[model samples]
Target: MTTITSAQAYLVDIDVETVRTDAVQAFLKQETVFVSITTSDGLTGVGYSYTIGTGGRSVLQMLRDHLVPRLEGQDSSKIEAIWMDLFASTRATTVGAITSLALAAVDTALWDLKCQRAAAPLWKVAGGFRRDVPLYDTEGGWLHLSQDELVSGAIASRDAGWGGAKLKVGKASHREDLERLLAVREAVGDRFDIMVDANQSMTAAEAIRRAHSFEPVDLFWFEEPLPATDISGHERLARATTIPIAVGESMYSIAQFREYLERGAASIIQVDAARVGGITPWIKVAHLAESFNVAVCPHFLMELHVSLVAAVPNGRYVEHIPQLRSITRNEMAIKDGHALAPDTPGLGIEWDPDAIDDRRVA
Candidate 1:
């Protein structure tokens, strides 16, 4: 057995190019928690998770003080068993962000090691459903951007042959949101898919009202209109809207996804591997969504998500946001509106150690 001989974790603060705003908050920075593990045989694997701004130190501490020690002497190939042990250890925080994020870093590192051992790429190792998954842009649209900026960005994305682009909703006035949507729709015409995300900022009633207002523009989906935990509210809004309801970024567990899926609260699954405890539970949630005939369009971390999305039959779209560019050597492979999964062995993140070291926080 390949025993894990050593494990280490660190925190790095990544700067955001612009003020990323949704209805609830502005993204201040990205605090990334990176984990690396080495086996007795000398192979090494690295993985990471993130917080939009705060709480990265907590995740790093969890990995170092609690999770890393437990990983010592464990078989690196026993990914599922290791994950379960970690999950059991963090029972009190099983369904929370800090625990899940910590687990994700460790779990992903294990998978990377496992894949490296087998000499296979993660998409093939996971399932190999497709080499390419469709791409959509979330970076182009922010709630704080002016209507002209929004239109120009959408047009640029469309001209570049991206499948679609997302727009942030939840302005003070519903009419303002509608007007922006209309402007973008008129600029891009009916061919381009436009997804609207409110970032879980509305009441169920407000969501339902906004859904109706957005209907005429031919929106691809209305995302996170209400809060993430409001299952009943989501169900009501889902029933009231014709546009597909996309959610799952704020969700931390498969059980929470089950609750949403069972009640028909979400039509599109936006499960985040970093938040859902890495590729292990992320796959469970994806398969669960598949069983329900729902599409999986994961949120953020496009570099890692592209491979996972391409690995699953039900995987739909990969959100385009280049948050890790400075620290990674390769960019996401985008061709003809779709992202091609990396053929390299392991998770495919080419970490620039010097870059990460330069940005290290704690």
Candidate 2:
């Protein structure tokens, strides 16, 4: 059995080209916490977790001071057991960002180590549903863009052969949001899907009213219109609107997803690997959503999600947001309208060691 010898963590800050804004906040930067684990057998595995613009230091410290020490001498192949140990050891920080994000770095690295040991790519090793999943563009549709910019962006996405485009909603005037959606719909025509994300900015009643107004444009999914805690609000909104209600990015616990799924509050499960703990729990959430016949279109880290989404039968779409370009060798490939799962062994991510070293913040 390969025994873990050491684990290390660091942080990198990736600057966004255009400041990404939505209803709640501006995504000024992406802070990724990278973790690498080495075993006695001389095998090394790397993994990472992210925050929008903060908390990278906290994730790094949690990994170094608390979680990494526990991994010493453990069997690297036992990913689930290791993940559970991390989950249990960090009980005080469980069901929140710091613990979950820290666990993600360790758990994902273990999975990578396991896959590398097997000499198989992550998609096939994970489950191998399909190599290609349809793509939806959110990069071009930030809420800060003008209506013309939004329409042009939708047109560009359609021209580039993406299946859908997501527009940020929750403007002060529902009329302004409606105008932008209508413009995009008119530009992209009836065939291409148009998804809308409100980023949990509205109350239940406002969300219901806005959902009804958006029906005329034929939205693909209504994402995070109400706060994640407002299960009853989401249920009310889901019942009032024909459009599917998608949720889960901000949710830090799997039990939170269960509440929404069992209650029919969220029709599309947008489980983010880092936020949900790691690939281990991420897959559990995917299967949980699958059992409910809900679509799993995960939130971020599309580099990793491409493989995870392709592994599960019910995974519907991969959000096309390339966040790790500055420190990674390959951007995930998109052909026709779908993102292709990488055939590279061990999580399909090739970190440029020098690039990562240059940007190290911790």
Q: Which candidate comes out best when scored by lDDT?
A: 1
lDDT of 1: 0.93
lDDT of 1 at 5: 96
> Per-residue lDDT tens digits of candidate 2, residues 61-88?
9999999889889999988888888888
- For each candidate, how many residue pairs have backbone atoms clashing (under 3 Å)? 0, 0
What does candidate 1's lDDT look like per residue over 1-362, in tens digits? 99999999999999986679999998989999989999998999998999998899999988888899899999999999999999998897777999999999998999899889989999999999999998999888999999999999999999998889999999999999999999999999999999999998999999999999999999999998888989999999989989999999999999999999999999999999999999999999999999999999999999999999999999999999888888889888888889999999999989898999999989
lDDT for position 32 in model 1:
94
Error of 2 at 169 (Å): 0.7
Candidate 1, after superposition: displacement of residue 138 in Å?
1.1
TM-score, model 1 to reference: 0.99
lDDT of 1 at 298: 95
